[model samples]
Target: MSDAPGPDQAGPQTQLPDPPRPPLPPTAPERGGPRARLLGIAGLVLTVLFLPAGLVLSIAALVTGVRSRKRARRVLAPAPGAVAGIVLAVISLVLALSQITLYAIAWDDLNGYVTCRESALTIDDKKTCQDEYLPRIEHRFHLPKGSLRQDPSWP
Candidate 1:
């Protein structure tokens, strides 16, 4: 006589209750403690500094902040300052490498000039060899091979 089906025919109510709510999202950093804020700030700054030492410090600060925030049940956010520090460090390294590359290019040119002169001298073109090569090598390196037979001086 009941309109609803009995348990055997109901098929477990067809609709489930809402799943238990997920843990609430953390509130923003303003809700965190002073120490957490400081760690975040420090991490951001060190990352910007870009130096090897700065990078190390920045990483430490970031780790500290993350740990502290987790313990405090606060929201954690990446600091812009730390990101800048990391960028700076990378740029500095790149610049150093570029400078080295330029110096290597110049050095190679100088070596080529010296080698050409040595070849000329081997063919008894002493005047051409000395005029084109010797002074430059002596001025730059402060020494030149005295005898080709004994010193190849490729390096």
Candidate 2:
């Protein structure tokens, strides 16, 4: 028989399989749940309104957001709300820290001013101390002159 098959002699042709498809890219985590979203909103609002409360709320939100993100990541879903909450929490934390630092500096300056006045050797020296430090403290804190006061009750 001839090597080449005629129409009648030809058997059913075997089809080649298609090439394998590439794997899909990883998807973002799922959106955070209701509690997480609420916490994010609350945290952001408190951060703007009351710094101390905001700091606390921000910490709570960060914790909640991180947990929500972890849960979503396990399921391979998007967690946009959780991510936003985390970001807002970080900003709130930074603002709270800055305020705390400023307060500490102002307190230290006031204390130093009191010490300077008490340690002055004469009326002139006391006047010089006030003249030198009062302006600096006022300028730094944007306070009116002579706003700093020393109370005997305070240690």
Candidate 3:
């Protein structure tokens, strides 16, 4: 027999090289932008709890949330928390403004009442002035009736 193997005893077969694998898709730098979401939530909580500090925190949240959203858009990600933060900030600001306005009206009404009472010559005149003016002030300020009379010394 020749040195080469016979047909029945074939030599070892050659193995083919593996095909190249496709490159993986690029990953986002931020993992779902959780930092932005957290900041937004923190801002909303602060705004609700403390008005004075809330203004600053709310503004910061807005800025951070906007920046996060822009970055997320570039990566085609969602930013729902940022939108919520902005809405909450606006609501807190409105509440603060309304509270300030109410306090001012209350102060004005009290001052007016005191002035009216001081100008009266006697207890009957004071009573008459209070009866006439208190109702008008309450109506104008949308205060509950007898709100000014809660303290007898107010008259």
lDDT of each: 0.49, 0.74, 0.67
Residues 21-126, model 1: lDDT tens digits: 9987544432333443444455445444544444454455445444544544443453323333334434444544554565575575566666776677355575
Model 2: per-residue Cα lDDT over 1-155, one tens digit each: 76777878866689999999998764334434445556767767886788777778878878878887888879867676777778777777887788778778788777777898889989898878777777788789887766653534432
lDDT of 3 at 8: 93
TM-score for each prediction?
Answer: 0.25, 0.50, 0.46
Model 1: residue 15 alpha-carbon error in angstroms: 51
Q: What is the C-alpha RMSD of each candidate to the true structure, in Å?
A: 12.8, 11.9, 10.1
- Candidate 1 ranges with C-alpha deviation above 4 Å: 1-75, 108-155
Count steric clashes of candidate 1.
Answer: 8
Give the winner by TM-score: 2 or 3: 2
Model 2 bad stretches (over 4 Å):
1-34, 108-134, 139-155
Name the runs in model 3 displaced over 4 angstroms: 1-40, 107-140, 147-155
Choose the strongest candidate by lDDT. Answer: 2
